[model samples]
Target: MKNILLGVMLLLAMASFAQPDTAKWVRAFPVTDYMVDISDSIRLVQVELPEGTSFKEKQLGLLKGIYRDAQQDTGTIGYGRCHLIKGHYYYFTINHKQSGRKPKAEDLLYTMMDSKPVYNGAITKLASHFIGLQEVGGSALYDRYQVFLAWTKTDENNVIDSIVSDINYTGSYFLQSDAAMNQQIKSGRFAGKGVLDVMMATGKDEVFKFLEYMAIKPNLYAGHEWKVAEIFATWLVSGAPAVIKE
Candidate 1:
């Protein structure tokens, strides 16, 4: 009897969460014909919530799930995130779910691009987080963050040069295992490497090019590792903490 009651309660909770108020109000990411042309590589279906509503993580249960399903029905998406634009909170999903045919961006919506993405105050916030992490004194984390922190001191010109150098360089950092990587770090194997090496270890060049793509032409990096690179960029620019998933 107790188990039955518990299961009933869980179902009720899930049902409520599955249709939260956020889902009541939503639309597409202001799609335009010009946007569709530039959006060829953009895999996510960008949806905007009603104006004047702030995005609360707890309130996104249904909203997230709704988009997750939408993504499945759309072939362009690979992942997702909630961001703000034009005084409204917008959620973008990399739409991977689809039937036999992929939808064109022009068919997704009919609107014009109104605003652009800005780095905003994220750079300063990112710096503060790195400082806090370094003071905590975890050797591996410190090594990882140090590269980003060094980025704080340089100009865009130097940073872009380094990114290009990594892209042009031929050496790839491949490791046999996590243990081997830790051993490499201990031995200073990647000492002269650039900022991206912290997250990707040996995939620095790839990460650099991806991030550069995101910075210079975000829509061009629709799928294929864009979200992970976005997460790392958010960490470096917005001070989001690192989450390593093995």
Candidate 2:
């Protein structure tokens, strides 16, 4: 009896040790390499604001100034960049157009206009709500042409809940294809288990948190009609589990 109990305990311990980490969760994506590029860019730009300036204040001022300058010079809307001073440490990608190219600093200075008070007010509300939920560490990206906003993981549980609730209430668009892309990886027989295994090994909680965020709204990326699943499949076939070949 004693021997059997000891064996059972050992088995359980082994299983726990075998569980994948959070990094593995991210690795489960077949298109992880490409996704890595995007993720890396996001990570690189993540920032936290200074104590005195609020995220809302910085965003509003930056947007107003940039928009005003752009209108005066080009007589059109353009992309801009804003830095938040509190909570999260990151830069935001403000859209002026549909192209994925980076906007010029000059353009960033031109998006601050007083003409669209109503629109600007709504934007302020939405931006502040999202920033409020973000962990002290996360980033946001705004698609100018589509008027869409997307965010990454943060460390605060309360902020996470706020972000999720706000997105649901606001009916904001998100990157649905990213979730679908991850789902496809999980659906595969051989690769699915492996991906989950890796994610569990890396950061299970973080991976699940990201998954939950994606499950919240209609995917804005879906409008592009790009078959992210297909892209993921091809990437998997070529090479997956970036840390390990095959």
Candidate 3:
């Protein structure tokens, strides 16, 4: 009996070590269902604000949703953010040292305003809710122009509840690791080796032109729609303040 128990403990220890580290995987992607509400037709427009102005200060009308993405290189630096309010898309960027000086709120620049959407449908704003759930998985719903995510291993057998549960599982994990993602922006192994081909093919190139401008390889994983979902989840959390571009 003693020998058998010791063997069992050894096996359990080995199994624990064999388990893949899913934390990074979970952070790198989203776990949710993205469905566009067709009746929700809102024209999104890009807007510019003077230096250091708080977007929340502007009565942008109920603050529908928001998204933030940013990165930097040696010479040029960029921070981009998007706000959806009352069906209007107000997007802007903060370029560090674009004029070869210190960054100030007044130094922000607004890029070209395209009618293109930062996302295809209404965004679900879930903040720090799903950061602890394990056994997560994700996929793209290109037909809906969105990504789908759910638990890979769960006892909940009901298909409906399983679907509903994902509502709160947006890409909060991604934002939680903003520092790591930004570091990857500069020195990721997959840096700029054509990881953005699918993204570029989807008419979303302008959304990430900062990567091109800085000559850094886009560090996002393809098909998972991590970028889109990160922006999607930012809507409700009201998101982080613009950081100085590295």
* Per-residue lDDT of model 1, residues 1-246, tens digit only: 355335334432432221122212111223222222125433434444344323443122111121222544322222223333444434333232332233333223211112212221222122111111111112222221233223333443444344333322322222223324222222233343332444444244444443433333222222112223324433343332222224
The predicted structure with the larger TM-score, 1 or 2, is: 1
| 1 versus 3: better lDDT goes to | 1
Alpha-carbon lDDT, every model: 0.29, 0.27, 0.24
- Given candidate 3, what's the lDDT at residue 231? 36
**Predicted candidate 3 versus true structure: per-residue lDDT over 1-246, tens digit per residue:** 355335334432322221132321111111112212222232222443223222332221111111123222111122223443223224322222232322222122212111212221111111111111111355432221111122221222232233223323322343354423322222232333222221122222222232122112112211123333343223112221121355
How do these models rank on TM-score, best leading? 1, 3, 2
> Where in model 1 is the C-alpha error above 4 Å?
1-48, 52-111, 116-177, 181-210, 215-246
TM-score of 3: 0.18
Ranking by lDDT: 1, 2, 3
Weakest ten-residue segment in model 3 by summed lDDT: 122-131
Q: Best-fitting candidate, measured by TM-score?
A: 1
- As for lDDT, the candidate ahead, 1 or 2, is 1
